[model samples]
Target: MTTAERIAAAPTGTETAGHPGPLAYPAARAAGCPFDPAPAVDHARREQPVTRATLWDGSPCWLVTRHQDVRDVLGDPRFSAEATRPGFPFLTAGLRELITSTSSSLIRMDDPEHARLRRMLTADFMVKKVEAMRPDVQRLADDLVDRMTDGRTSADLVTEFALPLPSLVICLLLGVPYEDHDFFQERSRVLLSLRSAPEEVRTSSDELFDYLVRLAESKQHEPDDGIVSRLVARGELDFEEVANMGRLLLIAGHETTANMTALSTLALLRNPAQLAKLREDPSLIKGAVEELLRYLTIVHNGVSRVATEDVTIGGQTIPAGEGVLCTINTANRDDAVFPGGDTLDVSRDARRHVAFGFGVHQCLGQPLARVELQIAVETLLRRLPGLRLDVPFEDVPFRHDMAIYGVHSLPIAW
Candidate 1:
C-alpha cells in the first residue's frame, strides 16, 4: 500500500485483535500537500493534543502536539535527550542503532556533558561571529548564482546551487576539503534514509567517522584556521572525540541549510503573491525566511525525549520512564500562536517558531543558518527575477521517505 493509504488504515485508538493499538508515529503527509505535516498529526494537535502513539518497534510514547505543550516538554529538564536511556523512542530500528552505537553528540546528551561539549563551539556560532561572515556568504551566494545561470536557462537547483553553497561554506569552516564532498554527501544520504538497514547505517557512519578522525589527526601536526584545527590545538578532547564532534558539524552544517534553500524557493514559487511581496520590499526577506521556516518545518520526524521524572503536560500525566515525541511541525501550525498558520505570509511575525528546536539543546548553529537562508533566498530572487519551476508542481519529488523533509531535486528555469 502507498504511504498515505497505510497511514489512513493505521489503527487510531482502535481495537486490533482484542488489543488496543495507537496510531503510527511519523505518519505520512497527505499525498497532495507535501509541505504540511501529516494529517493525523494535525488532527491530534486539535483533538487529543496529548495522546499515545506507537513507534516502529511497537513501543508506546506520548505525542505532545499543542503549541505550548511542545514548548513545555522540550524546555523542561525532566525530559531527557539522551538516546541510550531505556524507553527512549526511536522512529526506526536503524536510527536507534545509528545513534546508540555512535559517540553521543550534543543533541543526544543532557546537561553537564551536553553543556561542556556545546561550550567549545559556542563562540564560533555566536551572533557576532556569524554576522562577520555575512559578506563572505553573500559573495558566495552571488558567485554561485552567476555560475549557475551563466549560459543555462534550466538546471537542477539542488545540485547546481543549493547543495554546493552550504557545502562550500561548511568545508571552509571545518577544514574538510570541499572536493571530497561527493564521498561524504553520499554517506550522509544513507545515514538519513529511513529505510537504510542497521548495517548500512553503521558502515556509512563509520566511513564518515574514520574520515573525520584522519582529518583531525592531520590537523594536530599542521593546524589551520578551521574549527577542527582549533579544537585539536586546545587538546581539550581526544582525536576520536574531536572527530565525533566534527562529524556532527560536517553533516548537519550543510544538509539542513541546503534543503531549506531549495525547499524555500519551491514554497515561494507556489505562493506567487508572497514572492512578489519580497521582490517589492527586500527588507521582508528576514521575516520571509522565518515564515518559510515555520511553514515548512523540515524536521518531519518529531524530536524525541524520554522523561527522567514524572511530568504533567497538556493535562496529561506522563509518568517517569515514558518516552515523548514533541511534534514541532504540528505545533508550528497551531493557530493559538500563529493565526492562519497554514498559509505562507511573508509579512507575518513568525520569529517564534520552533524550527531550530527549543531549550538548551536547540540547534547550536542557528545563527549561521539564519544568515545563510536570508542570503540564499534573497540572492536567488534578486538574481533570477524570472525564476520558475521547470516541471509541473506535482512532478517535483519530495523527500517523504528521508529523515529530513524537502524536495529531492528542484529543477528550475529563468
Candidate 2:
C-alpha cells in the first residue's frame, strides 16, 4: 500500500490505537516543559512505535520512536544517509540545499569514503587525545565563570558562557582564529536556523566555505597542529574537500556543544533537587552530564536516513527508498529503557542513551563533547553556588525555530 493509503487507514482520534493518521513529523515540545519531548512523541511511542508522518516537502516518512527501534534503524546498513537522493527526507529546505550542493561531509557520506575521511580525524578525538585537553577545558570553563560572576548579580549565560567556551575550543581545534567567532557563529546560526530563507542559508554557507577554503590554502604553506593544518600537511584531500570537512567540524563541534551546555543548565536549574545532587557531590559530574545529555537530547531534529532496501523496524516493514526519522528525544525517554523516563535523575546510568546517535555514523567528537560538558557544568556550579535563573522561568527564550533545540539567551544570576 502507498504511504498515503496506510495513513488514511490507520486509526486516528484524540488518541490512537496504532500509528495515528498522518501525524506531523517534528512535533513541537510541550509548553512549560522545554526539557521533555513533545507529548505527541510519547503518544506515538506508546501507541505506534513506528508510524508514518509527512515532511515539509509532503513526503511520507517512517517516524521511529522506540529506543531499540531507533538504534535498529540507525545501525542497519540498509538505511542510507545520502541527502542527495531524490526521496531523501530533509529536516529543512535550507538544509537539503546545503547538503546536496556542498561537498559531502563525514555525516553525509556512507561507509568507505565516510570511514576514510573520518579516520583522518579519529586520533584527534580518541579518549586519550580528548583527556589531554582537560586542563585546557577546565581553564576555559573557569575563565568563563569568572567573567559571568565578576561583580555582577546577573548575566546572559548563553552569550557570556555557554556559547563562547565551546566556540573557542572548536576554534583552537580547527585552527580558526578566535576573533572570527562572532563572524562564524552568526553564519552558523543562520545556517542552522529553521527560520532562515534558502537564499540566506546559501549565502551564509558560501561565505563560510570560501573563508575555510582560504584558511585551508594558507595551512598548505604553514602547517600547524590544528585539524585543518594536519589535513593540509597530509595532502590527501583537495582544498574543497578539506574546507568542507573543516566546516562540518567547526559547526558541529561548537553548535551542539553550546546548546547542550546552555540547555542542560536550564534543565538542571528547573529541577533543583537534581541540581543539588550534582553540587553536593562533584564525583557525580560525569554521570550528571550523561543524564543531562539523555534528558535534553538537544539534537532532536538531526536523526534521519533513507532506506536503501526494505527494512522492518519495530515490526513495521519500511519499503526501499522510503525516508526514516529516529526521533532521539522520545527514544531516550523510552519507558522500557528508562523507567520514570521524563524525570531528571543525575545518578541514573544513562550510558546506553543514543544522544550521540548510533552505528558507524555516530558522532565522532562525542568524547570531546563529554569532556567539555563535564568540565563546563561542574565548574559553573562550583564557582557560582548561588546561580539561578534571573528572570521568570517562562520568560527565558527557547530556540524552537532552530534545527538544534536550546535556549537563545539564558538570563541567570549568581
Candidate 3:
C-alpha cells in the first residue's frame, strides 16, 4: 500500500483491546520551558523507558527512552535506517514522501552502501581536518561580529550572526554561491517543517535537487576545491548521486549548526551563572559546547529505525519489521548517565551525549559542528560583553512548529 493509504488506514488513537493507550509521540513541550524535552517524554523515560507510542498517523511504534536502550537500538545492526523499508517510522507524512521520493543519502541507506558513501567525505570532516579550519571559522566569526556590531547596538542575532555564519562556511565548503542562500534557506525551512504538506516537501526537494545537479554539472567543466567539485572530479557518482549527497550535506551542514548556535546562545542567556562561568574561563568553552549539546539535544524528534530481526531492548523484545523511535533528548536526560540532566551546567562533563547520535550513523560532520559552535558561541560572548535580550524573555518566538527546535528569532542588544 502507498504511504498515504497506510496512513489513512491506520487505526485512530492508541486504544487497544487489552492494553492502555500509547502516549502520543512527539508530545508537546511545556510553554515556558522550551529547552527541556516534552514532559511526557521525560515521564516515559522515568516510568516506562520502553513503551508503545503512536505516531502522527496513529501508527503504533516502540518508543525507547533510556540512554542505554537508545544506544543499543541505534548501535545494533539489526535495526535498519533505510526509510523505504516496510514499517520504518517517520515523524510526518511529508518526511516519508520526501525520503522515499528522493535518491537515498547515507542517512537513508544501510550497510555497505552507507559506509561507501560515508568514506568518500570522511577525510573532509576528520577531527584534524576540521580543526585546521578552526582558524578560518574563527576569522569568519570575527568578521560577522564586526558586521553585526558596526554602528548597531542591537540586532536580530538569528539573521545577522547565527544563520549567516554557518551558511557562509557551508557555502564555501560546498562551492555553492553564498548569494543564493536565500533560495536554498527558504526551501530548507519548508523541508524541515512538520506542518509542510507532502506537495510542499516534494516541490522544495525537487528544486534543491535540480539546483545541486546543475551545480555539479558546472563543476565537471571547471572544478574547484569544494566537496561538490571533488565529487564531480571522482567520476564514480553520477550527477544525481552527487546532487543527492550535496543536498544532504548542504541542508544538514547549515541548518543544524545554525539552530544550535542560536539555541545555545539563548540557553546560555537563560542561565546567567553558567554564562558568567564560561566568560571567566575561556578554556571551558570546549566542555561547555559538549554540555550545551547534551542539554539542548536539538534534534527534538527522536531518531527512527525499524527492527530487522527480533531484538530485546530495555527488556522488551521488538520483533522484525517493528518500528522504533529512539528519543535521544530523553536519553540525554537519563539520570543514570547524566545526573541532574535537565539543568544546564557549563562546567559539567557532558561529553558522552547522543546529541550527534550513536553508532555507524553518528553525525558525519560533528567535528565541523563542534568547531562552528565553539567559535560562534565564544565570539558572541567575547565581542558582545553587553549582550542581552532586546525583548522580554516571554516575547521570544520559539520554533515549536518546526521539526527542529530553536528560537525563531532572537532579538538582542549589546
Which digits, one per residue and each the tens of the lDDT, describe model 1 over residues 166-285? Answer: 999999989999999999999999998899999999999999999999999999889999999999999899999999999999989989999999999999999999999999999998
lDDT tens per residue, model 3, 1-414:
533344344343345653545777767777688899887778778877888888889888999999999999999999999998899999999998788988888898888899999999999999999999999999999999999999989999999989999999999999999999999999999999988999999999999999999999999998999999999999899999999999999999998899999999999999999999999998999999999999998898989999999999988899999999999999999989999999999998999899999989999999999999999999999999998999999999988778778888899999
* Backbone clash numbers for all candidates listed: 0, 0, 0
Error of 1 at 211 (Å): 0.5
Worst 10 residues of 1 by lDDT: 12-21
Query: What is candidate 2's local distance difference test score?
Result: 0.88
lDDT of each: 0.91, 0.88, 0.91
lDDT of 3 at 351: 90
TM-score of 3: 0.95
Q: Which pairs clash inside model 1?
A: none
The numbered model that scores best in TM-score is 1
lDDT of 1: 0.91
45-122 in candidate 2: lDDT tens per residue? 898788788777677888899999999999988899888775688878888777787777889888888899999999
